[model samples]
Target: MTFRRQVMIILRRDLRIEGRSGEAIFVTVPFGLVALFLIPLALPLDIELLARIGPGMFWSVTLLFGMFITFRQSAAESSSQQEQLRMLGVDPAARFVGRAIASALLLLIFELILAPTMVVLYAPAAIPGWPAIIPLALLAAVGLAMIGTLAADITASLRSRSALAPLLVAPLSVPLLVPAAQGLESLRTKNGIMVPTMFMVAVVLALAVAGVVTAQPLEETT
Candidate 1:
C-alpha cells in the first residue's frame, strides 16, 4: 500500500477502536477533569492566584493524562497484531504517523474540554490575545502526542512500561508544557506570545521528525 494509504488505514483502525471503547473520552477525560477541578481546592481561594496559575495547571494535567492515551495506543496492539501488520506490508513510519495523528486528535479533544473548564473555574481575566490560545492548544496537543508515541514505542517491550513511559515523556515534554503555560500567561498579562509560541512550534516539528525517523528502528527493536 502507498504510505498515505497505510497511514489512513491505521488511523481509521485506531479511531474505530477508540470509538467503540470510549477509553479516551469516558475514562481518561473524566480523571483529567477531576485533576483540573482539584487544583483549585488545594490552593488558597485566591481568584487572582488561581487565574494566574490556571494555564500551567491545565498543561500539567494534560501531559499527565495524555501519556495514558499514547501508551494505551501502543500497548493495545499485541505482538500478533503487529506481526499481522508487518505481514500485510504496513510501513513503520506510516504506522507511527497514523498513531500519532490519532493520539493528537484525542488530546485535542481533551484540551478543548479542559480549556473552558479552566476558564470557568479559574475565571482568568480576558485578554486581547485570547484567540491565540486555539493554536497554542493545537501545538501543545501535537507535541505531547508525538512525545507520548515515541516514549511508548521505546518502552513497548519492557515489562515496566507503565512506570517508565511517564519518566521518558515528562522530561522531554518540558518544552511543550513550559511554552504552553507561559504563552497563556503572557497573553493574560498582555505580553507578546511570539517567543514561547515559536519555541513550541519548533519543538513539535523536532519531535515529529524524531518520531518518523526512529519508527522503523524502534519497531525492529521492540
Candidate 2:
C-alpha cells in the first residue's frame, strides 16, 4: 500500500477499536467536565480573579485533560498482542503518524465540548479570537498527541506503571504548555492574534519533528 493508505488504515483500525471499547471518550469527557467545574471552587468566586485567570484556566484544564486521554489512547495498543499485529500490518512511521492523528482528533473533540462550557461557567470578559483559538487548539493537540503517545509507549510495557501516564506526560509537556499558556494569556488581553501564537506554533513544530525522529528506536527499546 502507499504511505497515505497505510496511515489511513491505522487510523481506521484505532477509531474502530476505540468505538467498540467506548472507554476512551467515556473517560475524557467527564474528566474534562470535572476539571471545568473545579476552577470556580478552587478559588474564591471573585469575578475579577475569574476574568483574569479564565483563559489560562481554560487552556490548562483542557490541555491536562487531553494529556490523560492521549496517554490512554495508545497505551493499550502498544502493550498487547495488538502491538505485534500493528508491526506486521503497518510501518512504524505510519503507525506513529496514524496514532498521532487519532489522539489529536480525540483531543479536539474534548476541546470543542470544553471551550463553550468554559465560556458559560467562567464568564470571561470576552472570548478569544476564534481564528486564533482554532489554530491554537489544533497545534496544542498535535504536540500533546506526539508527547503523550511516546510516553504511553514507554510505560505500557510496565504492568504496575500503567497509571503513571500523567506523571510521565506532564513534565515533558511543559515545553508545549508554557507557550500555550502564554498565548492564551495574551488572548485574554488583546483583540488581534498575539505574538505568542508564533511561539506556540514553533514549539509544536519542534516537538512534532522530534517525536517523528525519535519514535522508531524508542518504540523498539520500549
Model 1 RMSD, rounded to 1 decimal: 1.7
What lDDT would candidate 2 get against the real structure?
0.74
RMSD of each: 1.7, 2.5
Model 2 ranges with Cα > 4 A deviation: 73-75, 78-83, 86-89, 127-130, 187-194
Instruction: Quickly count the clashes in candidate 1.
Output: 0
Tens digits of per-residue lDDT for model 2, 87-118:
57656677778888888888888888887888
Q: Which model scores highest in TM-score?
A: 1
Where does candidate 1 have its weakest 10-residue lDDT segment?
67-76
lDDT of 1 by residue, 143-218 (tens): 8888988887778768988899999999888898888878767876778888888898899889889989999888
Q: Over 4 Å off in model 1, which ranges? A: 73-75, 188-190
Write down the lDDT of every candidate, Cα atoms only: 0.85, 0.74
